[model samples]
Target: MNRFKAGEHEGVTWVRGIAGWSNFSIKVFLYLVDGVLIDTGPVKLSGILVPFLEQQKIETVLLTHYHEDHSGNAPYLAGREIPVYINAISLERCRVKTRLPWYRKVFWGNREAFSPYPLDEKLTTDSLTFKPVSTPGHVFDHRSFYLPDKGFFFTGDLFVTTHPQMVLNTESTPRMIEDLKTVLRYDFSTVFCGHAGIIHRGREVLQKKLDYLEDIQGKVLHLHNRGLSVSQITRKLFPGRLHLEYLSCREWSAEHMVRSLLTGKATAENPRPRT
Candidate 1:
C-alpha cells in the first residue's frame, strides 16, 4: 500500500510518502523551496509522488545521496531535462542500476540508473542559494544542503533520531560522529530531514545525537580495549537484537554498529561474526 501527505512550513513545501503495510511501513519525506525539490521519495511511491510533482512548477532537483529512497524518481525528472544535482563522488554510482536486498526492494523498490549533474559549487534557485556540504557517515557520498539565507538545513538521513539503535552494515558510526560535529558547527535554525520531516529545534536535537554517539563510541572503545569481541561489545552496549536485524537478514544490526566503532570501517555485505 502507498499513502501520500503534503504540508508546508515557513515557505517550504514538504511531502511524505508511506509505503508497505501500516505495521511495517516506512515514511520518507521530500521538501521544496523556491523552485527546487530536495529528494525524490522512492520508486514505490512514484504513483503518488509523480502526480504530486506534475502539479508543482519544479525547476531543479537536489539529491542528498544515491540511496534509492532518496533518488528513486531521479530518472523521471531527468527524462524531462530538469537539472538533477548530486555529490560528484556519487555521480558514477547513479549512472548504473542499483542492486538492493529483498527487504529494501519490498520497501522502496529498485532504482533505475540515471545521469545526474555534479554538485561542485553553490546552487541557486529563484530566491535561495544552497551550500552543498559533504557529510559522509550515513553513506560514503552523503551530503546535506544549507540555505544560508533562511538558516535551513536539508539533511537526508543524517539526523533521523537522537539515538539510532540499528544501522545498515555499510554505515560507519565514527564517520557519522564526525559528520554530526561538522554540521553542528554550522548555523541552522530549521532542519528538513528526509525521514523525520522538518525539525524546528534542529540544532538542539543534533547536539544531543552527537553527545549520545560520542558516549556510545567511548564505551565501545573502552570495551574493545578490555579485549571484548564485537559481539560481546554489542551485547553489553545495545543488549538484545532488534527486529530489523532479522528482517534485513543482519544487514541492519547492532553488531555492525559495534564493529564499525571498533574498526572504524564499514562491515561487509555478509558480515562474519567478529568472535
Candidate 2:
C-alpha cells in the first residue's frame, strides 16, 4: 500500500517521493550520505518513508526546494531535527506562496495544501561544496544540485516526464526555459524532477524537452501571427486538450498553452468556451 520505496544506486539509497493517496502526483526526495539525510517529502505519505530514515540513522534533512508537497511533512520530520537548507529565494517564495515554489502551482494547477516553514539553514557557497545551480523559469528559486563525485543533478522541476507533452500550464516562464538551456552543458547523467518521473540518461530527455519546448513556443508564435484568438486556436488545434480540468484552474494550465499560442498570456480574453 505504501509507494515509498528506496532504491540502491552506486551505494546510495534514493527514495522515490510519491505524492497523492492514489495516482502518482509529485516526487519528493530523500538522499542519505554517510548518515546525513538530504531532504524530506512535503506530505503525510512521507510518513511511510520515516521508517527508512530511522533505520538508516539519518542525522540531517536538507531541502531540494521548498514547495508544499516537497516540504509538507516537516512537522513529521521534527524528531531528527533534520536541519533544512534553502537559498534566500526559496525561503521568500515559501513565505509568499505558502508552498514549495511558484511554477509548480502553475504546472500542476496550484496543487496540494499549504504549510509554511522557515528554512533552518541557508546554504551559502562556502557551506555546501556542491553549489546549487540556479535554474529558474520553472520557479524563481528553482535550483539543481550537483555532486561532482557521483555526477548527480537533483533537478527540482527542471526535468519533467509528463508523457506526450506537459499540458501547457501558465506556470511556464521564460526564466525556466533559460535555465534549462544553461543546464544542458553540465556533465550530469541523471535528473530527479519534482513530479512524475526520473531521467537517468539526462542528455536524451534534456534534448527532447528543450526541442519540444522550442517547437511549441514557435507554434504558439505562428498561430498568434495568423490572427487566431486563444479560443480559436484551442478549438481548432487543441480540442482534445480543452477538456482537461487542470487547464480550467486559476492558473489555467492547458489553457495557458493555447493562450501562449496567441498573446503569450492566459486570461479571460478567450471568447467564452464554444457551446
Candidate 3:
C-alpha cells in the first residue's frame, strides 16, 4: 500500500507504484497533468489504492491494460461512473478474453465481480503524442505510457525488471523485440515495470533483452527442428541447464511462447496450463 509521488512535471505528476508483489506489485503511474489516474491496482486492497487516491485531486482513470493485478480495484473505483479510459482492444479483453480460465486465474476475482466499468472515451490521441506507445505482447491490449518531456516510460509488464526468460508461456517475446526496437528510438531516462524494480538504464537493458530474445528464437527454432518438444526446448532454453531461473516469471509468460512454438498459436486463456 505504499505510494511515492514522483518529481514534478509541468503538466503531469506521477504517482509511481511500489515494489513488493512477486508480479503482483508494480509502479503504476497516475499522470497528474490532466488529473488522470492511469491504472488502478488490485481490488482487494481498496484501502491501499482508493483512500490514497481520495487524498489526491484526480480527474479520471486511464487504465493502461486490464490484468486483474493491474486492474484489481476497478469495482471499487466504479463506486461512481468515473470516466475510466483504456484502449478499445484492452477493454474487450477485459470483458471477454479475461473470462477464459487462463485469464480468470491471472486476474483472481476481477471477472467474477464484473460490473460495467464506466469508460468515458477511448484514447484517440495521436500515438506519437503524449508518448503513448502501444507496446503490446504481455497482453494484446497493453500500452506503454511514455513521458517524452519527462524522459520516462511506464513500461507496465512489457519490460521485466527481473531477469528475462524464454519460458514460452508469455506471448510477447517476438513482440517485445518489436516494442523494444520502437521504444528504444525514444530517449527515455527511466522505465518502470509492473514487477521487479524501477530500471534506470532501461534503454541498454531493452537492447540486451532484444538480443537475448533473438538468440532464444534461433535456439528455439533449432531445437524444434531437431524434434524437441516445446517443453523440452523451453526447459533447456530457460530454467533447465541455463540457470536462467524466473525467465518465465509472471512478468513474462514463457509457457505461452512455447505453446506458440509447438502448435504455431500461443494463445493463453485460463485453460489448464500446458506445462
Candidate 4:
C-alpha cells in the first residue's frame, strides 16, 4: 500500500507521497498553486493521486521534466483534456515509452506515453505566474519553476539532497554545479523540492549542495593529479561501499562522481584519468 500527506501554504497545497510500501520508499511531492499543478506523483500511487486531483480545480500541469516519477500521471490528466506542459526535449522523450531498470520500474513504475503541450518561458494562471528555469544535471530536460512575485521555486530533483552519495549514471556533476550556480542568481526564498518537500532556506541549501559537489570535484582532481586512480579516489573520499552501489548493481556509485569530476562525463564506464 501507498502512504501520503498533504500540506497547504497560502494558496498552494503540497502533496507528499511514498510511492511504495516502506516509509523509506521513494518519496515524491506534487504542488498545487492557484489551480495549477506543478507535477504529478508517480503512477504507483495513482489511486490516491487521481482522486485528490479530481477535487481540485487544476487548470494545467507544468511538468519539471519527463522523469517517470514526475510525469507518470500526466497521461491521466491529458485524458481529461487538461493540458500538460513540458520542455520540448522532455516531450519528445515522453512521446514513446522507454524501458526502465527493474528497480525503477518497481519503485516508481513506468511512465506511459503522452502528448505534452510545449512549455513557454512563462506560464500564468489567474493568481500566479511561473517562469521556467532550465536547470539540467539530474536530467537533460530538467527545469525549475520560479515564482518571482512569491519568492518560491519549484525545483524538481535539483536538490534531492545536498550530499547525495550515489548519483545516477545519467547525472553530470559538472553540469549540476553549473546549474546550481545559475539558479542562485535568481531571487527565491523557498524551494519546493520534488522529494524533500518545501524548504524555507532553499538558497542556503542549494549553496551547500554546490559547495559539496565542488569540494568533491576538487578532491577528485587533486587525487588524480597525484596519480590516483578513480577507484583509489573513490575509496579515499567515500571510505566505505555505499549500499546504493550494490543495490543499483554499480549503475550508480561513488566512482561515478570521481569519473564525472575527472572526465566531465557521468556514465557507468570510467574514462582514462586526465594526464
Best by TM-score: 1
Question: Per-residue alpha-carbon lDDT of model 2 for 100-143, expressed as tens digits?
Answer: 23444333223232233444333333223354687654544456
Model 2 TM-score is: 0.72
Tens-digit lDDT track for model 1 on 160-207?
A: 999998888768899899999999888888999998889999999999
lDDT of each: 0.88, 0.54, 0.58, 0.84
Q: For candidate 4, what is the lDDT?
A: 0.84
What is the lDDT, from 0 to 100, of the residue 228 in candidate 3? 89
lDDT of 4 by residue, 35-91 (tens): 789999888889888898888888899999877899999999988999999997666
TM-score per candidate, chains pooled: 0.94, 0.72, 0.71, 0.92
Which has the higher lDDT value, candidate number 1 or candidate number 2?
1
- Model 3 residue 244 lDDT? 24
In candidate 2, what residue range of length 10 has the lowest lDDT sum?
Answer: 266-275
In candidate 3, what are the lDDT values of residues 92-180, reduced to their tens digit?
Answer: 44544243334235334443233434343333333223446787666666778777656877776777633454433445456766778
The model with the greatest lDDT is: 1
Count backbone clashes in candidate 1. 0
Show the lowest summed lDDT stretch of 10 residues, model 1: 266-275
**1 or 2, greater by TM-score:** 1
Better of 1 and 4 by TM-score: 1
Model 2, residue 96: distance off in Å is 8.6
Off by over 4 Å in 4: 21-24, 268-275
Cα-based lDDT at residue 112, candidate 2: 33
